[model samples]
Target: MAEHAGAQKGDVICFGHTHKPWHREVEGIHFVNTGSVGRPKDGDWRAGYVILEMSGDQPRVEFVRVEYDLQQVMEAIRQSELPDDFAEYLATGGIPRPVESAADAE
Candidate 1:
């Protein structure tokens, strides 16, 4: 995530962490979030991506979410040693709501 400090409308910034799809322009700066490829938080539960088209000095952005065999993905998670919570995230978009801490579970 290149902050660039002072980004303009024509200047775009790309980043992903919240796993939520988003595209907005504020203070003449373009902000884009690609979400996730395997697990998304946008409640669509599909692979998400962004397409940026630069026409001259201006730029066009598009967000895309692709659906696939989620069953296979869950299977892979089950086979792996990853935490069960991860599977839950994949099953229900990104991280499960009401995030419970380890102490809370205890």
Candidate 2:
């Protein structure tokens, strides 16, 4: 994955997953994950985003957290005719447990 991102001896790379935000240099390349916006299940309530600046000799990384209207999302969900349980989970942050797989039967 790192090679595919064009990361060489001195290149910058940025990627996001796992709902974690970070900024740092690896092997002379800068890598960053902007974190998650919707389900920032992390302890912090603030949603995550990232910014980069290359004007300076060294790249700059900025992480910003902004709050939006969650109720509007709920209201939209209400109008979508989706299942009530789904909406309830969104409003309450109560994730449903996943069903066990046969591989786990051992």
Candidate 3:
């Protein structure tokens, strides 16, 4: 996909929306996925971000993860009238647990 982005050599393209963090270089074009800062779907509950440093014609990229009070966020969602599944998604890092039916328990 980076090749189709019309990036030339030594060009860096940073984007994030999928909530999955990733970085790669294709044909001298640097592609970076900055990940998510709040609702991360990369199997990591922590906040994800990136740091880009450019010095003297060189560019550096750094991926950062931060931990916060997930319980508090989940509690807020639980109290708001949002579906419980939302909290579950945050707790599980986008992997939703299968809801067990009462009959299945028996």
Candidate 4:
């Protein structure tokens, strides 16, 4: 993500691409990631976002996960033309088929 889009020196940079969430300050600017709302991939069941605020001299970051109906997502998946296994994934949170290891080839 592009941080400091026309931002000044004292601006905060927040972005989320990697499923893992993090917050830190480099030099003077604060860098943060809001994390993932779906398929956190961190093995945490919570789906959420992050909220940041400057409290005095330090920046405060909070991650919030709201309860959502997975059934609705599942139903949408079922109704859509997506593969059936997608709904299966939603229902069971099971990992999809694993790719063959290089050792298996040799």
Candidate 5:
């Protein structure tokens, strides 16, 4: 936002790296994060995304969650060389458990 919109008023920014869908306004700037489509980390399962509708002067943001065939996804992964961790992630929407750090090894 700082780079593109420069904190301009009414500026809307969208991103999805966190895979946690959300919509909010901060400092007069609007932000929406369209969560992952194939693998969300919000623990709600199913595919997730956001839909923005500009009906009037204000933009309406809606969070959409769609259900897909989980069995097929698991089967395809099982038949391929993909890591089991990937399949597990698709099966569960929970954020990945943090790994132990070097400090924890001490």
Candidate 6:
């Protein structure tokens, strides 16, 4: 991923599309993924985030998780036209399977 992103040595890259928090250093490049705060898909389920501190020439990364009112979000979803599976996904942190099509089954 770094290769495609043209990341170089000593570069710090931060991204959060996957909703799963992670950090790593590759060939002097630092990569940080600051997971989702509301719709997390990382199974542990609490809101996930990250803190990056730069002291002098060194960088420090900290992952943070916080508790939120899941029931309130679920209730809102229940009242909406969206499918119930959305609420379930928020509770379990597991993505709902895509609905299979008859043509694709072959």
Give the best candidate by TM-score. 3
Weakest ten-residue segment in model 6 by summed lDDT: 1-10
lDDT string for model 2 (1-106, tens) is: 4455463554567777677778776555777778777655444444568888887568888988877676787678788888655555555444454668999876
Query: Which ranges in model 6 have alpha carbons more than 4 Å from their true place?
Result: 2-10, 95-106
TM-score of every candidate relative to the true structure = 0.72, 0.58, 0.80, 0.61, 0.77, 0.77
* Candidate rank order under lDDT: 3, 6, 5, 1, 4, 2
Across residues 33-102, which tens digit of lDDT does each residue of candidate 5 receive?
9988886888876988789987765789999999888889978988899987777788767667668999
Which candidate has the highest lDDT of all?
3
Per-residue C-alpha lDDT of model 3 across residues 20-48, encoded as one tens digit per residue = 88888766667888988877887898877
**Residue 99 displacement (Å), model 4:** 9.3
**4-94 per-residue lDDT for model 4 (tens digits):** 5335466578887886678777666778888777756454545778988888888899988766787888788889999866666644434
lDDT by residue (1-106, candidate 1, tens digit) is 2455264434777888888878876666678887788767767777878898988766788888788888888888888998867777887886457869999999
Query: Which portions of model 2 show Cα errors greater than 4 Å?
Result: 1-10, 78-106
Question: Candidate 6, residues 1-106: lDDT per residue as tens digits?
Answer: 6583464545688888988889887766788999898888778667778999998766899999998888998889999998987888888876665788999898
lDDT, model 6: 0.82
Query: What is the C-alpha local distance difference test score of each model?
Result: 0.76, 0.67, 0.83, 0.70, 0.79, 0.82
lDDT-superior candidate, 3 or 6: 3
Candidate number with the higher TM-score (1 or 4) = 1
Q: Pairs clashing in candidate 1?
A: 8-28, 9-28
Q: What is the number of backbone collisions in each predicted candidate, taken in the order shown? A: 2, 0, 0, 0, 0, 0
* Candidate 3 or 1, higher lDDT: 3
